[model samples]
Target: MDKSLEKSLTLWLKQQQTVCAGYLKLTVLFGILTGLCLLAQAYTLASVLDGLIMQQLSLLTFYPELIALLSLTIFRALLAYAKESSGFIAGKKLRAQVRQTVLNKLISLGPSFINTKPAGTWANIVLEQIEDLHDFYAKYLPAMMLAGFIPLIILAAIVPINWLSAMILLVTAPLIPLFMVLVGMGAAEANRKNFSALQQLNGHFLDSLRGLRTLILFHRQQAEIDKIANVSNDVKQRTMSVLSLAFLSSAVLEFFAAISIAILAVYFGFSFLGHLEWGSFSLLPPTEHRLSLFSGLFVLLLAPEFYQPLKDLGTHYHAKAKAIGAAESLVTLLNIQDSSLTSHITTSLIASSKASHTKIDLKTWELEANNLKVFTHDGECLLGPISFTISGQQKLAVVGASGSGKTTLVNLLLGFLPYEGSLKIQGIEFNQLDLSHWRNNLAWLGQEPQLFHGTLMDNLRLGNQTLSTEKAWELLAKANIDDFVSQHPLGLKLSIGEQAAGISVGQAQRIALARALSRDANVFILDEPTASLDSASADAITQSLTKETTAKCLLIVTHKLSQLGAMDTILVLEKGQLNSSGSYDELMAQNGLFCQLNAQTAYDIDLQTSLGLNS
Candidate 1:
């Protein structure tokens, strides 16, 4: 990782600590208490040994010290448990906060931006990548703090007993973290590659599953399987590389700690044998400078405890690297600025500007567009500087060839895309209105109706949960699917599996239409609602839509020119510009794009009939 980027990620991670700071503080407190208990336990054990050897005391005479040691041992265990529990709580809260933040950002970006990436890519980031951050909060952060504080606590107790042993510990302590950082630098890079590979695998696997039917129809399933296997293998290799680096880091820390402890043990052994004694705190003469067994035993007992924190820190260093790797994707997504949806004006101002606020009267609503153009993030125009007007209770159809920006125009109206020039709703600038409020006044249906896994009643009442069962039947009747739903064994209780698994596509579209009508929106926008339906189903939907939207403004984007003849006004688009705008009969009379589109539609129908595909 680059130095600056690493620093930024570290800062970002530290900032998130504020969300669960109390729990984290408790973790560190319990850890410090555990360290104190270790110091007390070592002292009591050292005193007992000194009394038995130097004072020639019996085991019965040291009952108090033995009992104190036992009590300290149990207290240390309890403190350790509390530390872990606090860390777990802190990690859980932080993950939830971060996950909600990511979800909110995705929602604000809207479908226009979200559709740019595969569904699995977003799911991977939101779930697996966020999960990888757990250990950093739960283990690494508290350990980092304790690694500094605990080692110092041990040194404080050891220094007075033997300065040389304390100096040895101080010298070796820096080495553990130094090598840990060196190993972690490589580990961080490996972890980053591993996360990237996992994201790719997730996205590819999900996309393959979604397109499995198409792949089988073309006899390409085997090739897709091979590709998936290759991606999975790559992820496995990268994951192993990360694990290898983590193990290497632990090995390095253990090697240095064992060497440091061995050196302390050798010093104590020599001092006990009267070979060297100046390092110990004894007041004997120069030639008879001898170390007491109590001091030597105390220093030796605290030796391993001194290096324990640093070793544990080295072990959890890999968690820091893993979290930094996961944070890369998270930060990138959260930092994305969807300039189109952002507005400096407050919602209150936007709402208060109109007397009726968000609740505009549906009967008198008017939409006007002048020189309207939609632009991509790069400022490239997707929809042109065209103009149109929709007045009270008007039915308009926008017809165009593929890539002619028909969907872009609808997206602009739905507030999913930003536009330049004048777009006004009831004389108010469209951009100045609160989007959430604006969306409430509009209902939309796309080519593929998104029916989730739920009962028919649950799906229908999505926009209006308080809707009565009687009102729901009325909506189904309006969409012309009441008979089909009523005939089912469960009626409104009928369960529609994910993506309408048990229902035909036409029936799903009708159910979606009923759900949309349940919103009682002032404006209705349908984009190819009947594109894949049979003639009978399509005609029924068209008739239901015409009847239901009679009192509301309707805009339909379609290629079937036959049903469009009844549209009050039709706008023909070629490329990104509007070729012409008139009634269907008026456009048919002219030798323009509309006539060519109508001729193409007729040809497609004849071709389908001859092939018996329409049956």
Candidate 2:
């Protein structure tokens, strides 16, 4: 195994105390019963042979030996069943516990961190890799412990009767496991690569499926199919290579084990035939002789069974390698540190510390930014060194072209990422405030609203679960979606597909707006919430928002030139730099870019409206 994989495996095993100990005990007990059964079978065979050789073959005379063999077989089967059942229980419970722990990590990591990871990778970790632990727990690990302990038991049982046979068996048995360790390591590496390829293929397939419409529009469907086919072929080739390695390793182990057992059989047979050292105890067979022969034969029979566990272990090694690769990725994802303005939650996972610190020194009501800087992952600066403030329930409109860092600014304030320089709310340092509590005091509606797999009411309940159905209808009435939701046969029970596939984009936006309103947060950030709605719907939403019931701060980011008139203050951003800031007339009076841009926007809107081209 790779060093990292070995370390992780060690960590995983150490943590599973009760489960591992239970499995170990059960396995040993089963192995003991199985070894005893082999002993009984060998002794009965020798006793019956000696009786027949001496012309004393009678079923009634050998009744005791037959009964002993039958009892041992029955007990061994019962013990084996118990071992399997206990293993199943342990595997199930451990999978559940580990799964819950992983989920908790995902939840605590929050959306920002999760967004950075691929959905396919997350699916593989949670669904596939965690499930792979079952094979190791239920099958391979038990057999490994048995492999080590059973050989010693067999050697001890035969040592007194025939030391030469015991020596041969004991000396050569370790060769199988040793050879496995050296040759099977390659299979582990190949299996890890296969799993990674599989994950990439899955990710590519899902992404293509999601963007199938875009592919058809661009006439790239056949190209995508060919690309996926190539990935499939690569996966198949890698899988076959890994399985071939497993097969070769098993064959090697079988050959070594069979040869070792054959050598032991030769030594025992020679001694019994008076061609080798006929010790005083060994020379007493044939009705009164060969007592030692019975024990040696029994040890010989069990020697192969002992090595069979090792062969099975070789196969599981391949499965376990794939599982470990998936697990390593999962551990990294689950342990991703949430280092933003949001509060950090620490846990005893990964090697990282759980320390929560805050930037203190600002008050909670005064908004100010000093020398702020934000950079993208690729090292391109989005915003920087810009200072501004919004105080006392003020409404500010942020306007700019599409790529001028408008959304990036909102992300900064939402505490999704870290920034340089100082940002304060009410003079309280933005980082010092408890982020979860701070977020609870804010509500946001982005250009695209996210809806999960649930009913409209069920999704809405995420905002305020205590709200009654009657109250929900009232909120929907305000957002102008009451009729649409009510018209459905199931009404509140009407199910939405994943990502709100059943709803139009406009309706999804309305539901998001309703969700924000339900929170009743002190600060509301609307990032072009009306971007997708129809004219009448947009007008109704803007009107409803304007009639605010509470004194709350509002910041709206929009490219809707017509909506500029509604803002108490309008701010313009150009090339990530704030160019103009003031009330509508105040900026337009200066007649800078803001005035020129507004004029061009109005002219275009008028033309589109006249030509019946605006959607």
- On lDDT, the leading prediction is 1
Q: Which stretches of candidate 1 lie over 4 Å from their true place?
A: 282-289, 338-363, 377-380, 426-429
The lDDT of model 1 is 0.83
Tell me the TM-score of model 2.
Answer: 0.82
lDDT of 1 at 567: 86
Tell me which residue pairs clash in candidate 1.
Answer: none
**Model 1 agreement with the true structure over 172-279: per-residue lDDT tens digits:** 889999999887776777888898998899889999987888999999999999999999999999988998898888889989989998998888788888788677
Residues 79-187, candidate 2: write the lDDT tens digits: 7788788777767877787788788766544444556656776777787777877766776667767776666766666666666666677777778778877777766
Residue 509 in candidate 2, Cα distance off native in Å: 1.6
TM-score for each prediction?
Answer: 0.91, 0.82
C-alpha lDDT of candidate 2 relative to the true structure: 0.71
Go through the candidates in order and give each one's C-alpha lDDT.
0.83, 0.71
